[model samples]
Structures are given as structure tokens and as C-alpha cells.
Target chain A: MKKLIMIFSLGILFLLSACAGENSASGNSSQSTGNKNSEAGTKDGKQVVTFWHSMGGAGQETLNSIVEDFNNSQDKVQVNAEYQGTYDESLTKFNAVAGTDSAPTMIQTFEIGTMSMINSGNIIPIQEFVDKDGYDMSGLEGNITNYYSLDGKFYSMPFNSSTPVMYYNKDAFKKAGLDPEKAPETFEEVEEASKAIVKSNPNMKGFALQAYGWLWEQLLANQGALLLNNDNGRTDTPTKIGWTEKEGKSIFEWVKRMVDDGTFANYGTNGDNMVAGFLAGDVAMFLQSSASARDVIDNAPFEVGIAFLPYPEDQERQGVVIGGASLWMIDGKPKEESKAAWEFMKYLQTPEVQAKWHVGTGYFAVNPAAYEEDVVKEAWAEKPQLQVTVQQLQSTKSSYATQGALMDMLPQGRKIMETALETVYNGGEVDQAYKTAVQQFNDAIEQANKARKK
Target chain B: MSMNPTLETNETYMYQFERVKKSARMKSFIKGMLFLFPSILLFSVFVFYPMFKTIYLSFYLTDAKGSTTVFVGLENYLNMFTNPIFLQSIKNTFLFVFYTVPPTVLISLFLAILANENLRGIGLFRTIYSSTIGISVAAASVFWLYLFNPTMGLLNKFLEAFGGEPVGWLTDPAWALLSVSVTTIWMNIGFTFLILLGGLQSIDRSLYESAEVEGSGYFYKLRRITIPMLSPTLFFVITVSMINSFQTFGQIDILTQGGPANETSLIVYSIYREAFVNYQFGSASAQAVVLFILILVMTVIQFKLGERRVHYQ
Candidate 1:
């Protein structure tokens, strides 16, 4: 009788647990209606929108201010802003919510995902709202749309756009008998400086190049090499990899030499060790996204310096490709809600906000007009080091590789490179490694392309 | 036929209900089915459906706009087999499992025995020894990474006091994987320890008393009685350890990131890189399917071995 009672209770508990799992509510209840910033918050029948952004610290504060301003100006809706953990987490949550059709009306997605998000039938085109509203989109700088426009149709709003740059230790350079002011202009010069720095200071490493292929992609495209075949790797069927050619091979060899000689550390073979290494003072120079500047500054105990990205010898360079995330608008949301989102996006793009974002974070202002604006100009004058990215933009032209990478299996291509890089960094034969990696990556790409034919 | 029609109808309804209620095997099967149905449905949607979809997808072409999935039998499999990194990753994973599982299980067993002894303060010692399990893999790995740094690391610092040269734990490819393995064993020892301890405590004390009456020493009694009685727990611990070792990702990712070289590229991490980081979902799914098959084979082998050898009273 006791055993039967125990069994019956266990069964009862299990059923109750299962029901509880479904009934459990999500992260927020209030924002499911609309944002706290909506003008409707001021009057009756107002909608409330919940927005999840990964931007925190000062970025969150700025967004809160924008929300406050919008709330003060409007009388119909309140936009509630919440901080999501990271870009990856936000997208994962977005994907999950999208299935439930309860997704946040606005999200901050990274640039690499913008095209894929559009093609996934997940998002509404921002161009529609712009064309219909006839809001002064003319205020938007040309470069800002470079992230959102796919086949001339805007898929999302641009936020937190960034390009890679070379950040060096000025004091370390001075100690190594290199110029603190006159940074390396060519890749060879950079290599020489790195070698010199390592030789002079045994405790100090030269370069923190995380993924050599990514760095190679940056330099190769800068040197006018088409890194990908078939519409320059843009959301289309890729016939072949242009990196298989001599120019691409040369870039890999140079990196291999740097790795072999121990002049360059690739962190964890195929990982994001460079940023940590640089910040830890393990290396003297770091090649990374401008977006990393905030963390590096906050974390680094050393004197920091910013410089234009180094180029190959005698190769006039186009600008370094932008390598940050963008926000994509999802469909299935009500028209009014999307319009509420649109208002927030437009407000975010304003010069005052963009300038403030640029100052707090080292990311380049997507709004080129932000450069001409008084606040930004004053900030630049006060801190001349901030203009290094803008200088790269003026010099560099966007390449097929630079504009965007297109692949059915884009991520696998990078993994292949990461593996090859790790192999060689850990003492595997170089030529054999890249050859093997290239074949496998291409194979994965081919297999992926075939799989998408449903 | 001679009975009233209502009585006959009542009899049939009772028979159907009794059929469902009796035959414990049938009842249990139906109950199990009902119990597992929700999880099965979820797994089908998230795991199996995607898996079959990938198998379906592996033969087609995809882009930003649309996908054209077609039948390309054996091509994806052939391609993966020919790939060196994939091949290396499989080998690396096996090596990692081999390195981590035995030492981990044995050391944990040793600790469990020590902790199981009826000392004055045994409970305190057990708690202290088992506390490492609570530290998250990321946090523990971060602490270990700094401690294991070749130069200026605490380990090297202690070693240098003995007049030894600093060893690069993570910098050198040869040692990086093992460095990660040591941390894994340390991190995992507590879990296996607890299992073996529970097994030891549950052993019939009378078995040990009988061994003692036979004039057995501590070691002899341990070998003769305790081990035999604890074989079930040992089997469980070994199986769990091996499965957990095969699934090693967080430590490898946080510490070595499958590198210094591809020394630490476990199969699942490689699968993750392909699926999320590289956006090669189809091949990643293929890899996952292969990994699942491998795991299934391992599990089946374990159960078969356990059936043959495991002694339970």
C-alpha cells in the first residue's frame, strides 16, 4: 500500500511538473505589449513595446536617454528597453521567439547575419517603412546603408558598425627603438617592428593575430585581391575560392612565416586569443575590430595607441572592410509596432546619438555626416587618435571580400581556415595544412550548396 | 448469448478496461509511451527533425534568398571522410577520451575509498574533496589557465623554486591538450568520487565483517569483498565518465580552444564550429549524425559488456 501510494504521488508530481514547464512565463510580461518609450505612454490606449539590446554600460544609458526623449515627445506608446546578454545570445533568443511569433519588434543583430536574416523569411524590409513614411532618410550617411542594403533593398537598420584597425603600445614602441608616432605603413614594416619588439623585450610578444585567414582576408582584399569567386561572394552561388590563387597563397605563406618564427602568436590556433593576449600585455600589437576598443581601454593597464591598418609593400589599399553587426526588422509584427521600432531606429541614427556612441565606444560612426557634425568634430580635435579609422575609410575601396562574404556554408569556410591555422601554429606542415584545409572547406561549401537545393 | 444484451455490453466494456489495466508489461509500455511522448516530440522537432532535414539538406544548394535541396547520395559523406581536419578531430577526440577517462575514474575511486573510511572527521574531508564540482567549467578553466601559464604561472613559479626551467603549458602544442586534460580530471574527480563513495557506503558491512573473520588484512578485504560488492557502482561510474569524457567541450574551448594546434579538437566542438561559427549547418548536421552513431555504438557496447560482467546480488 505504501509503495502504491509513493508511485501514485510520483506520477502526480511528474504531471504537475510537465504542466508547470509550459505555464512558466518568459523574461518579461509588461514589455510584451510595447516599449516604455512609446508616446502612447503619455495618453490613453497607448501600446508598450519591449526591446532587447546587448548594448550595456554607456550604450545602455544612451539608449535609455533616447527612450526618455521619445516618451516625452509622444503620447501613444511606451518603449521598454532591456539588456540582452550578448549579440549571439540576442540572436539565439530572437530565433527562439520568432518561432513563437512573440519576438521583440526591434533587435540589434550583427552585420554578418544581416543578409542571412533577410533570406530566412524572418524580417521585414526597412526600405518599405522609409519609402512610405518619406522621413528625411537623406540625413543618413551613404556608408550607413552599406550594411543594410541587399540587392538595393534595405533589410535592417545599421547599428554598431566597425572595421578592424591596428592598435599598438606606444610605450612599447618607444622602448623597442621604433617611432611611437610614425606607425608601420606596410606589412613588411609591421613584421620588422614586431620582430624587433620581440628581440628587444624577451617578455613581450610581437603580434596577436587570432585567425590568420581573417587577417589575410583583410590584407589581401586591401591589396586588391578578390578573395572569393562568383559575384565577389555576395549571397549567391560561389563557383570557386579566389583565395586558391597565388595572391591568396602568398598572404598565407607570409603569415605562416610569422607564426613559424614566433614573431606572431595566433592565440589558441583557431580562437579569439588575440584580444585577451593584447590586453594581458602578452603582446605589443593587436589587430582587431574597432568595437574592441572600449573593452581594451577599460581592461588594459598600458598606454594605448591607435594607427591605420598596415598594408603590403607597394600595394595601394582600399579601406578595411567593415566587420560588425546590424539590426534586422522582423515581419509578422503589427504595422504600428514596426513603425514604433522605426521611430526608435531613426532616433538612434541621429548625429547626436551616433557621436556619443563613437566617443564612448571606439566604433566608427556609420554616419559619415557625424564626422561633419560639431560634436564629433570637437571630439576628434580633442582626441586625434580617433580619426585613424576614418583615414582608412578614405583610402580603402570596398572589395568583393570587403563588401561581404557569400556562402551557403560561410561558417565552415572560416572553421577550415581556423583548423589549418591551428595545425600550422602547432607545428603541422604549412603547405600541406592549407592545401588540406582548402580542399575540405571547398568540399564543405560544395556540399552545403548542394543541400540548399530543396 | 443467452444473457441479457445490457449485461453482455457491460461485460465487454469491463473486459477492455481490464485488458488495459492488467498485463503489467502492456500497461507499463503504454504508461512509458505517454510519459516519454512529450520529450520525444520535443526531440523530434529540435533534434531528429533537424537531423533528417540536414540529411535532406546535404544534397542541395543554398543561398541568401533560397535553397535548392536535391539528392546527392554519398557525396557529403565521401567529402567529410576525405577531409583531414575532420579525420584529425575524430582521432583527437578518441585520444582525449583515452587520456581523461581512466585517470579520472581511478583517481576518483581512490579518493572515494579514502573518504569512505570511518575516520573521526571523514564527512568533513568528503565535503572538502567533493566541492570542486560546484565550480563552473569556465571559471575553473580561467583559474587553471592562469595557474598553468608557463612563465610567471604559479605552477612554474613553484617549479622554478626547484631550479627547473619554465614549461609552456598552453604555448606548446604537444602539452596543451594534456594540460587541458589534467584540469578536466581535477574538475571531474569530485563527481566520480561521490558516486563511488555512495557505492562504498551502501555495501553490506557484514561482507567486510566476514572477510575480517577470515583473517584478511585491510587491502585483502578491500580486494576480496568491497570491490566485488561495488562492481555495479564502478560500472555506472566508468560508463558515465567515458560518455562525459567523449563530450568534453567547455574545458577544451575555454582553455585550449582545440588548439596550440588541432590537439584538442573534440568532435562536438568541431561540429559546433561548423554549425554556428561557420554557418555550415548541413555538414555540421552530418557530423552530428556521425557522432550520434558513434555514441550509440559506445553505449550499446557498454550495456553489452555490463550484462556479461556486472555482478549484482
Candidate 2:
């Protein structure tokens, strides 16, 4: 009798679920909700486009205002902007729709997924789009432009790009008897400093690298680790992984030392926790995306110092990879929608907007033109900390480590490396784990590739 | 009609056969609708339709130029099982279930019995015992993670106050799964407690009195009368708990994230990583199917074992 009732209730529940509306993946679908005026294109033969991005804060507001300006200025094209969730979620959701022909006209993708998006053939090549629309990207930031292009073909419109930097707590450093102004310049120095700082103050920690393998990847790239050996540096073939090189070994050794010493901890394995620990004075230093500086300064209880990542012992840096995402244009959207999206994309690259984004959030302005403009120069003139990110941008070069990795199983690879690090850090063998992980990851890649083949 | 008994008999036999056939058909139809309703509705809405679509899409390659999905079958599943990460995920899931299920079942049953006393302020005790149910898994996991922080968690704080060194609650590979299981047990105890409580309340008082008349003590009475009588509810709770533990995702996602060496990655969490995170929907669906079968087998085993113990009065 009880089991009958159980079956009966479950049946009813299932029936009801069939009628219930689906979850619209709430995060991305409504970030920048605007007035729903028309499902139709623009009036007077104009092209109306829908653009989606996850840029929030002043940058989001600025993008909205620019869109409104574009809508007002051109009767030929009306741009409607929408906000998706963070870059990663947005790309995944976009692909699900894009797997069919129903994709947003334009969507944002992280730098890591750029080659994958290009290889997928679903997104429109920006070079083609620009050629057809006759839009010049000459006014955009020169360095920002460098990261977005592939083989002289601009596949994405770069926006809101930032690099990772060290965020330190001055108060914790002072308590630990370490000079807050002098940042560690190498991995060995960081290790020794961390041990000293940890001893000096119970609450103070010397180092907390946010993404273990992710940081390692960056460090290796800056230390001249080639992410891929072929495919014209992430242009031709996409889906090759190269982590068994000298770079991989060094990174493992460095991380294993930190884990053994207990100076670094990431239970959730997220940068947010590291930031939280730093802000709460549990840790003295953090290496995270430069964009997070403002939020840390605002929420932090002590003076926060920002600095460059420690150079590897080899010392000749290959330059840092650009973190954050870019926007990909879809090929099949209505002309009006594509035009509106293009206009919105161009509007975000303007000097005034870039400068405001740089100042409001710690993400440096990508536009070189923005820095030369009086307004942008003046904004940074009084505030030099904001300039640190841009200054690093000057030293930044386009490399596989700092720029991106072109592997089909990177989303999977991240887990592989994370688990390997955790195991090694917890006193597991690094060499054995790496061999096992690489073989497993390659098998996964072969599987994905085979699925793709089928 | 009485003129010829044979004619009457023949007519009655045909009528009876027709009636019986009609009844059988109607019975089967109603029962079929009842059973089919849940599975069809759920499969169409949640599991089935999505799976059918996902499997259909497993074929074809994706590239920046375009996404072309061809019709492919079995390839995705074959690839998944062959992959070491996926295989390791399987091993880890089983390892977790091994540690979690037995401890949770035994401890929860004990807790239910202890709290079943007819004492003062029993309501307060019940509330305290079952309160964690109200907490969201994600929210509970966050608290659990903080508690397991090796350097400065509540667990370490207490341990240190006793002049003992801190143990890695969720950090060490050996301890990670145990730590996650501990949180799962605490969070879910309230649910099974309420189940056993209802069963305990429903047991007849007359039976106990009869046992007392027979000179049976509390232990003997509990072992003979209560255990046998409560077997049905126990069977149900155990089955549900097993299934729930197998599908465990929240704690792993939030607390350990299937780490300290994938020590806590359950099948469902792996499915999430494959489908949502890696965009390998086809492979993920295959995993979901495999998981569904594993749960079905376990549930069947529980029912088979239950038959011997259950007494339907």
C-alpha cells in the first residue's frame, strides 16, 4: 500500500514536470534586461541586432549608454544589448543553442575557448564580418588587438581583457616582518618568504596562488613554455595539448613544494576563496586576475598592494597571457541583428569607455588610443596603481601560455591537472601522476575527437 | 431457457469468457497508464527527451567554422568508458559509497532509536536531530568546507584547544571522502529520522505489552517484535539513501569539488563535468544511463532481501 502511494505521487510529479516551463538558464538570459520594443528589425531599412555580454559594473552601464547612442545616431541600425552570465557559462549555453542553428547574433567567449570556437565553425570570422560591414578596428587599443587576432584574421572583438597580478595585504606583511613594498621576484624567494611570514604571524601567509595549474600554465608561458608545437601557434589545428614538456615538470616541482609547506590552500580550488582569505587576513599575498583589485581594495580590511607575478628562476620572461574573454559573431543571424551587434561591439572599444572601465574596475583599458587621449591620460595621471596593469600590458607579448591553449579537452585537462596537483601536494608522486594524467587526458581527447568524427 | 440445459450452458460459457477478457484488458490498461505516466512524463520532460536528443548529437565535429553534428551511436559511450578520467571517476564514486552508506544507515538508525524515548522535551530533541534538512546542500557544503579548513576550521579549532594537532578533514586523499560523507550524513539524517520515527510511532503498543507478558526485556522485544515489524520502512529508507548517496553532487561540487585527487567524485558529478562543463552531452547521457541501471539493480536487491524480513499483517 505504501509503495503504491509512492509510485502514484512520483507519477504525478513527473506528469507535472512535463507541463512545467524549462529553466531558461537564468544567469545569462536576463543580465541586461531592457524594454521589449520589437521582435522586428529596425525601421527605415535599418538593421536591428541583439548583443549579449556579461560585463557588469560601470563597464556594463557604459556599454548600455553607448548602445543607446548608437541606436539614436543610426536609423539604419538599432543595437539591443543583453548581459549573459560569466564568460564560461555563456559559452557553454551558447554552444547548446549553437549546436542547432539557434545562436545569439553575438556572444562572449574566454580567451582559452577562442580557438575551439574558431574550429567549431559556428561563429562568424570577424575579419569577414568587418570586411562585409567595412568597419575599421584601427581606433582600438593596439595590445588588446594583438590578443584577439588569429593569423591576421580577427575572429573575435576583444573587450574587458585583464591579466593576473599579485594582491598582498600590507597589514599582514607588516606583522610578518616582510616589507610590503618589496614583492618576491622568484618562486624560490616566494617559498622562503611564505615560510618566514607564516612563522612571524599565525594569521599571515606568504603566498596563495589562486589556480595551481592555471598559475603554473601562466608561469610556464612567461618562462617560454610553448603551449603547442604546431598549428601555426593555435591557428591551424586546434585540440592538441602539450603539458609534458620541461615547463610542466618545473611547475609541478614548484607547486608540490608549496603544498608540502602548507603555505597555499584551495579546498574549493577557486580564486574567490584565495581573495576571501587575503581579505580576512588569513593570507598575506594572492595571485589573481588584475580585474579583481578594486573589489579587494573596497572589501579589504587593510592596505592592499598589487604587484607583478614572480619571474621564474630562468628569469627571461616570455610575457604574461591575457586573461578574460572576447566576443564571437555568428554567421546565420539576421543582417539587422548582426549590424546592431557590430555597432555595440565597436562602441565598447572607444577610448572614453575603455578609460572609464579601467578606472572603475581594475581591468586596464585595452585601447592604445585611450591612453593617448587627454581624458584617459589624466584619469591615470593621479592614480598610478591603475597604470600597473597597463604597464604590464606594455611588457606583455602574445604567447601560448599568456594568450591561450588550443586543446579540445582543456575543460577536462583543468580537472586532470587540479587533481594531480592535489594528489602531489598531498604527498602523492608527481611524475607518476603526470604520466597517468597525460595518458588519460590523451585518451579523453581521442574520444572527443572520435565522437566529433562520428 | 430451462427447456435445454446444454443450450443454456453453452450460452453462459461464451458470456463468461467475453466478460473475463474485457476485464483483463481494462485492468492492464489502467495499470499500464499508472506506471507509464511517471516514466513517460519524466523521461519526456527531463530525462528521456534530453537523452534522445543528446545521443543523436554525439556524432559530428564542432569547429570555429561551423558545428555539424552527425548521427552517431555507441561511439560516445565507448569513448567515455575508455577514458581514464571517467574510469577513475567511477572508482572514486564506488569508494565514496562504500564508506558513506553503511555508516550513515547504522548511525541514523541508532539516532532514531535513542531519540524515540518517551521522555520530557522530546519534541526539542526531534527538532534538533532533523533540522539540517532545511539547509540547502550548497549552503551546507560551504559551512562544511569552512569546518574542514586544515589551518583554521572549527574542527581544528576544537582539536587544538584539547592540545592536539589538527587533522586534514577534507585535504588528505585518505580523509577527503570520509569528510564529505560525514557532511552528507549530518545534512540528510533528518530525512531518514522522520521516516523511521513515523514507523516507530505506527507500531502497536499492544504488541509490546504482549511481549512484556511473555517476560521479554526491552532488548529481546526490540530485536524480535520491533525489528521484524519495522523491516519494511527500514528497507525503504536504506534503498532511498543508497540511491541518494550514489547521485551525490552538491558536497563534491562545493566542498571538495571531486578533488584531493578526485577522491570524492561521484557519478552524477562526473556527468555534470562531462556534459555541462565539457559540452560532451552524448557521453554524459551514456553515463546517466549507466548510473540509472546501477541504481535499479541496487533497488531490486533491496526488495529481494526485504521479502524474507517483511511481515504483511
Which model scores highest in lDDT? 2
DockQ (C-alpha based) per candidate is: 0.28, 0.30
Docking outcome class, model 1:
acceptable
Candidate 1 regions exceeding 4 Å error are: A1-46, A50-77, A81-89, A136-141, A144-147, A212-214, A234-236, A269-273, A372-378, A398-401, B1-68, B71-78, B135-172, B278-282, B303-309
lDDT, candidate 2, equals 0.69
Candidate 2 DockQ score? 0.30
Candidate 2 docking classification: acceptable
Task: Work out the TM-score per prediction.
Answer: 0.82, 0.84
**What tens digits encode model 1's per-residue C-alpha lDDT throughout B111-160?**
99999888998889999888888988889999998887644479878977
Determine the backbone clash count of candidate 1: 52
lDDT (CA) per prediction: 0.68, 0.69
List, residue by residue over A129-167, the lDDT tens digit for candidate 2.
689878887766666666677667798988877877777
As a whole number from 0 to 100, the lDDT of residue A219 in candidate 2 is 70
* Candidate 2 off by > 4 Å: A1-51, A55-84, A99-105, A132-134, A169-180, A231-235, A242-244, A261-268, A372-383, A398-403, B1-82, B114-121, B143-170
Looking at candidate 2 chain B, the ten consecutive residues that score lowest on lDDT are B60-69
Question: Candidate 1, residue B45: CA error in Å?
Answer: 9.2
Summing lDDT over every window of 10 consecutive residues in candidate 1 chain B, give the lowest-scoring window.
B60-69
